[model samples]
Target: MVLRKLFRRQAEPDVQIEKGLEKTRKGVFLEITRLFDRSEIDDELFEDLEMLLIQADVGWDVSQRLVKELQDRIAAERIVNPADAREVLRLEMIQLLELATRNRKVKILQRGVPFVILVTGVNGTGKTTSIAKLAQYHQGFGRTVMLAAGDTFRAAAIDQLKVWGERLDCPVIAHQQGADPGAVVFDAMVAAHNRNVDVLIVDTAGRLHTKHNLMAELHKLRKIMQKHVPEAPQEVILVIDATTGQNGLVQANEFSKSVEITDIMISKLDSTARGGIAFSVAKELGTPISYIGTGERATDMAEFRPDTYVDSLFFGEGEGF
Candidate 1:
């Protein structure tokens, strides 16, 4: 009962969380509010709003659902003012985003075994760098971590991961270029088990989802893990580039078909990319987005929280919460 109370207390509203979400909210609101002004709502305004949502990476189907709901509410209530319409639309969008944010907690590592996490994504999505940042984050929490350079297809990938491991003072397992990724993972698992490390983050090759051989390779990695530890690879996180916008959704769809993507980590959100794609991906795929990379810093990544994000969306002027 005491521990439960402590957990409930920690669940209280967080102001810093709202501050972190401000980056995503500001980008989204800028695109959305541009459609409305002092002018009255009209057919042109509706069309513009629809187009804006699509361009912001909100999929057509989800955008239509939002527009339809807004139209219904406006028609029933005789709403006309652009400001009022914007607020109503904002509220509806917030509600839709809330659906994607449900159960966004990351699973804690169980005791007495290394929590294996297999990271994979297309090249240029920041998979290896994100893994390093994640290692730093977990290490800050006093967890012993080992990284595996399973992307032996590219020599540069292996070198980059090794650089990160060295900088962070963590062990990294790697093989020669063009080697089997599964074998690298196997070696890493052996080292992790022998060293009794708290976590093992395996970095896999990044290939386009359309590439059948690459997708098949990921399947083989999973099969290898099951052979050693049935419950290993506790989490398979797909690192997505926020700048890709709507195209990210297509990648998510294809990857999900090939492997069970337990969570999503959207990176490079500090740029001009409208971060609304995060909402669309979560809404469409029904996968919990556990974390978001705001900047290149190791501490830039943050846990996704719905209430904070909603606050940032509605109250744009203030410091989120």
Candidate 2:
């Protein structure tokens, strides 16, 4: 059986998310959608569903749990039709994401207080670009945003951030390369505080997750942020490359070991066919995805909503899954 294509209209936000997930919807998830086109659910259906989910980069544990939940729901609800079973599966997936994100409160920037966001990730994960996108997001809210070049290990990192600052017309606080990162953070905190910047996004040097010393620097930066705002560094956003699939999960796991990751931003989402990393991150890491880098352009970003994300993965361009 094949998935059905129908003509329908989608909301603007849903349309953007659907376009961004086009690769994934046409990839492994396409197979999963076809699996539900059958007349009845069976053991073979469950097996194929579980395998397709894992192939999509949903972690092994999360895939198993989803399948088990589907089975239990089918039995308890006496669901025999494949279409009905598929709806149950959708609810389960949405519930998984909603549960993971339920505890988060909306971020509000108080007057005279700076909302600090510390971004971290391994090299080549698009951490700097994600920071730029985040700054643009805050700027959209009519809030003044400042950037801090906390990654003092590389001169190029500092220069790159300054370039972005110029493009955004936002101020960037930095020091000479190889200068103390703590000092940079301290100065940024002071500058943001005195300037009454509504939002402050700090960029850290990209390092392998296994590097202990580099991870320790994150702890020191958090301390510097605390000195200015009693509970500053309010958001620690981790950027992960979607194309890395399961390897991205490993990076998140290792980074979480060092500091509290308040949110996640999956970069290069449009480039990956396997978009299931969002599920694994939400399920395994217990971190809510705040934003997704939908495309290469700095403005090509979308605030992640669980319902929109799940729906886009299976349905798009009037296709019914």
TM-scores for the candidates: 0.83, 0.92
lDDT per prediction? 0.76, 0.86
lDDT (Cα, tens digit) per residue for candidate 2, span 119-175: 999887988898888887777667899999988888999999999888777899999
TM-score attained by model 1? 0.83
Candidate 2 residue 167 Cα shift, in angstroms, is 1.3
**Poorest stretch of ten by lDDT in candidate 2:** 1-10
Could you say which candidate leads in TM-score?
2
Query: In candidate 1, which residue pairs clash?
Result: none
